[model samples]
Target: MTEQNEEKPRNFHEMELDDRILKAIAKLGWQNPTLIQERAIPLLLEGKDVLVRARTGSGKTAAFAIPVIQKILNIKQTARHQEIKALILAPSKELCHQICGVIKDLTIKCSQEVRCVDVAPQVDLSVQKPLLVERPDIVVGTPTRVLKHVKAGYLDLKKSLELLVIDEADLVFSFGYENEVKELMGSLPNIYQAILASATLSEDVKSLKSLVLHNPVTLKLEEPEIAPESQLTHYHLMAEEMDKATIIYALLKLHLIRGKTIIFVNTVDKCYKIKLYLEQFGIPTCVLNSELPAKIRCHSVTQFNQGIYDIIVASDEKALEEPGNYGEKDNTEAKKSKRKKDKESGVSRGIDFQHVANVINFDFPLDAQSYIHRAGRTARGNNHGSVLSFVSIKEKPLLEKVENRLKTGDNDSIFKANHFKLEEVEAFKYRAKDAWRAVTKIAVREARLKEIKQEIFNCQKLKSYFEDNPTDLQVLRHDKALHTVRVQQHLSDVPEYIVPPTLKGMGGLTKRNKRKHDFRSAQSSASRFQARKSNPLLSMDFEGFSKKKKKKN
Candidate 1:
């Protein structure tokens, strides 16, 4: 067994990498090796299967990528048809594309030709089949797509496949790709080297070691400290469920969010709703959810990184649906099953969001692990960042659990509690309320209109009648009810009010007493109804029952 703590290389150049590869590293302005790079690169070059546990932004991508590129370069092949030497599987399409980009960058100056293909949902499989036929040296993709290609005979991994890399291994298992991964491993050569890397290795990943790796070297990097060196500030604010949107709006209005910010929610519905609410306030934002098309999701991330958008409202990638081809089946049960699968995807893992200045937990995470991942989005690679969580009264306990996990042995609190006074944003609250209501109303109306349009199109008689009576079509187009909900006035023009519900002293009343009070109110109403039914004067007095009867008559 090799020493786990062998003398590490001082720099990339000292690692005995090809001069061309060294030039590419220098071109990227990397002066020294990151800890993970320095440790993992050498062992990987020595042909050792490694299991790595390192925090995000630790240069783990390059740690494995550099060695893979070098190994491919070292292989001397004279055959016309090159086989895939390395297979890298990521949990999401975004991560797959990202890994491919890193590999391309590292192989820029290599003398030997290297063809890297990214097979993901965003790229058509039919298109990828031809590329696979070109005998690419490296393939980076999501597990499902890779498996699909392998099954379709478009990809040949049974022969000439030497190395297998699983990035974000914990996420890969959590996303329910264990079966696909197992199948891929079964198809590969038994003697191939396997590398699994993740921030945290859960029990599932630990169990996977016996099946895939043969006495692999485990590298567990020290977890990054939460505060001082990372310059990450944590703030937790309490707000009512209804007031959360308003508080977020106020935070934005006060310029509290500096630089590119990501607001994390636990559900897709909240992700879109918050996005619409923020946009209603004239804040331009994009939504990153699993339900979105692959191209749009990729474009959203690209635009965000390019500084085209300042704010992005995203759901936890785990809440998104898995990305792949489900074939042409439109059955109800199949659709429902697909939806359930989508809610379990872990798309957010392994994605690199460059220069994120802040992360706001719009919806408090269910557990501590989720909080850690959300906070990991910011404070990456020596960058200063902040995380603000919108904690409701009921969610305080969950917040406390996260705080306890983040605490070092010392008694000092890692998360600071910040009070968000309602009075400070009283005016903005009402405006936000009205804006949300108006947006929801418009959405409902549009959905209703779509149903009506579909019904009309589906009815053969109605379609022909409308075609014959063009004037009726014109009248339908001008229907006032169809356009009832319009953005005639801005939300800022809405009136403000303080209407906090009073729940004081409610606990003092027993259930029996509440039932008695309800009974008395019901008796009084019955007596009044009996009096109105029997006496003409009583019926005519104030109730206006006689007036309604006379109008009907």
Candidate 2:
């Protein structure tokens, strides 16, 4: 709500940014710099490595984009466009596209002579080499695919590279991508400048500082301490999974929350199940999970972004994974609960929506970290957002833990369905009756499909369990082949992460093994919960009082 403290540059024309870019800024009626844009862009122009931490919707993209665009125009003004001079690594295909689109739009408005293009994994691989050889002054893509091009000798980095940006570093590293990122950094030319941006930073990100940047300028913007009271409200539901759907249905029927919504679940399979059940109740909804085809997933996201769809039920993991986690490859624990896996899955951390007024956790996050990530999605960009978390008796400890850790000033009590006033919803019901009916129908169809998918998933799990113990060759082989087929299908559709079909060899699997271990290999003590990490910054403490420790173990 307060103005950002950073100052804007005086000579926009002399900054190397395209004339059209400046014109667009002038045309769009932007008079002064946003706090982030004002502060971050100057450092970027100086070619200093920057590590920016700002609230989502704090004009973070423009803060970074202006500099990148300026660098591109500067390059074209001096060097030939044959070699890619800058790389912007985003965590999702949609974001890559979004950034690219923004750059293109800005370039169009800034002046007459500037042009920009976006290159992502969704584009044909065959054309990639040619595109890099031909145009593509600014290359924006999901990390894995971009790295794949680098690995396969398709992208040449030997030319005079100016900038390397890792957008959403928190999501990239938290979702088991530390190694991949480190590897990518190792490959970049030594002289290139780096910029790391995120809504928040974790220890993994801190670890990245030494490896990628040199004497970086740090820009930190704290989100408003007070969330907007009018746009969002917080509520909790003590209900069973089945009953939760009914509550969601009731909320939909009442209608003050009319625009398209995203329902967050803990697991990938649950995304499908929720979509199906909500559809059965006549809500027009779709599932956005990693398991779906890439085109379908992209379409789902595009539709959601364009406000074409009303409700999207998705697992936190799927929405967050994309370039961050890669593929439908669920972690070992994710397979076990699907409903609640902490930061290991990347779902909770990745979702970014400025328009979302409500964030309903179909299954409450198991700890404070999940709570922070999910809640962070809404109330972004200085907007007030609401949170509705469903809790069952089985999850009380987690709910209590979250309340304590977040220092949620309110009392921790179960809210029944009757407490919410849905009368405001009924009025919108009449105004958008047709749209509502369509959403209801889609919700029902998606629910039915989800039920069928769940049955298949259950059958697969049973097949794995029944086959044998540690060395069931039959089950292992069967699961491996099935996994291979699934991976291939997913890859053919998305081609983001070209990881081999086998999941065991990668170092990423060690923590995964502990999570999936049977009762025999795993310790049965409550200590596991106590020792487990919820957020990189905050560890879970079943017993309420412990001084916050930032030291890594």
Candidate 3:
């Protein structure tokens, strides 16, 4: 076994690596080993169980990937048919894909055949089962999905599995996968090596040491103290709830944050609302939330990475939820379900947005941990980034909690608090208000139109009426056109009406339209109808009047 105190290699070239892997390293432009890589790679290559604590973008992926690829290559050279030798579990589909990509890239120059498969919830089990049957040498996936296959016999992990790597171990535990991870560890052969890597070593992760890791060499890399403090500057601006959106717009325009920027909100509704509000300023933005389809979410992230859009409004809603039982069974007696739903999408953990220039917490985070994760998205690996938070007056305590978390007794806290005067943002507030009204009106109108269309589709009588009388269809089309034109007009001018039709009369109408229809008259008419129903004399008089009129004639 390699000694942890041995002198570290200066660069990848000096390390004992296959020539092909060295070539791949050169291709990747990795001239020297990062601090974590220097400390971890050698230990991993020595066939030792290692636990690494490092931050994002510390070259942790390559540290494990290179050694794993080398091991897979050596195994492939000996056998004609490859079996599942290595399994890497990540917390999310995005991270799984990312890890698989890195592995594939590193193995590109290997002489022996090294096949990798990404088993994620997004991929159908039917598709994955066949791929597993083909016996890929490397499997990267989330815990629940991977465990499901192993338990069902689609994936054979008992015989040939040589390595189990749990990337983001803290996150795995945080995501409530401790039971699944323990089950997996128990199922794997006793001879295989395991490596766990994470940023923060919480109590939950420390507890896992007894279960999965065996005499693991722990490597805690000391980060270099860059001059002039951290690469991230944190700021908090105090504003009212209504002024937050305006302040965000003002800050973006004021600071000219046109580079790849992420605005993190608390809820899914806020995600789309912020996106729409920003769009009203002619700033093209994309949204990422748990409710978006998997394909769209993937595409959005890809495009953001490719610089298709400059801004992404994302929600931390899913991240804030307690990770539930992600496709685990209650007991052996319970019948097995065929498929399980994928974990909810979130931007908090294990997501690396490269070159993120700015992160704005459009809403204050739930707690200190949430704040830390949100800030982690930026200022990664010596890169300079800025975090601006919108804090309402009532959220001062939450802000203080975040500040106290980041405070080292000797140094100033990370957050620089500031106040915005009403006079300073007054004009911008009006403009933002107009934009907000316009955007919200448009959104409401579009949603109402969808509901109307669905209602029409479901109404058999309406369908028959439209089919029989094509003129009614034309009238409906004409109404749609008129409504669209009205919406366009509302974009330029103040909207006369903002409420959706479904919600129109439940409350009183707006004051401007109160004169158009007299509520008093309608109330009086209703009262008269009720009075007539209650009065037997009125009914008797009507019958007597009819009889007397007939007699007189």
By lDDT, rank the candidates, best first.
1, 3, 2
lDDT of 1 by residue, 56-137 (tens): 7778899899988888887844555578999998888888777887888888886358778888754557877888898789
lDDT of 1 at 369: 73
lDDT of 3 by residue, 1-553 (tens): 2235568455786667888888888897777787788888778888899988877656678889888988877777777766999999988777787788788878888634788898874656776788899899899988888988888789888889999898888778767788888888767887898888887777877877667788998887665211123466677878776688776665444322434678898765566566666555434466665555444455567656655455788878643453222211221212242322246345766776866767788887767777777877776655566677888776677888777767756567767554444444465677677766655646744533443444335343465676678565433211012122113222222122433232344333344543332222334334433432233112112222122322110
> How much does candidate 2 score in TM-score?
0.65
lDDT of candidate model 1 versus the reference: 0.67
RMSD of 1: 18.9
Winner by TM-score: 1
**How high is each candidate's TM-score?**
0.75, 0.65, 0.73
lDDT of each residue in 101-124, candidate 2, tens digit only: 667757775433344445554546
lDDT of 3: 0.65
Model 2 weakest lDDT span, ten residues long: 477-486
Query: Which one wins by lDDT: 1 or 3?
Result: 1
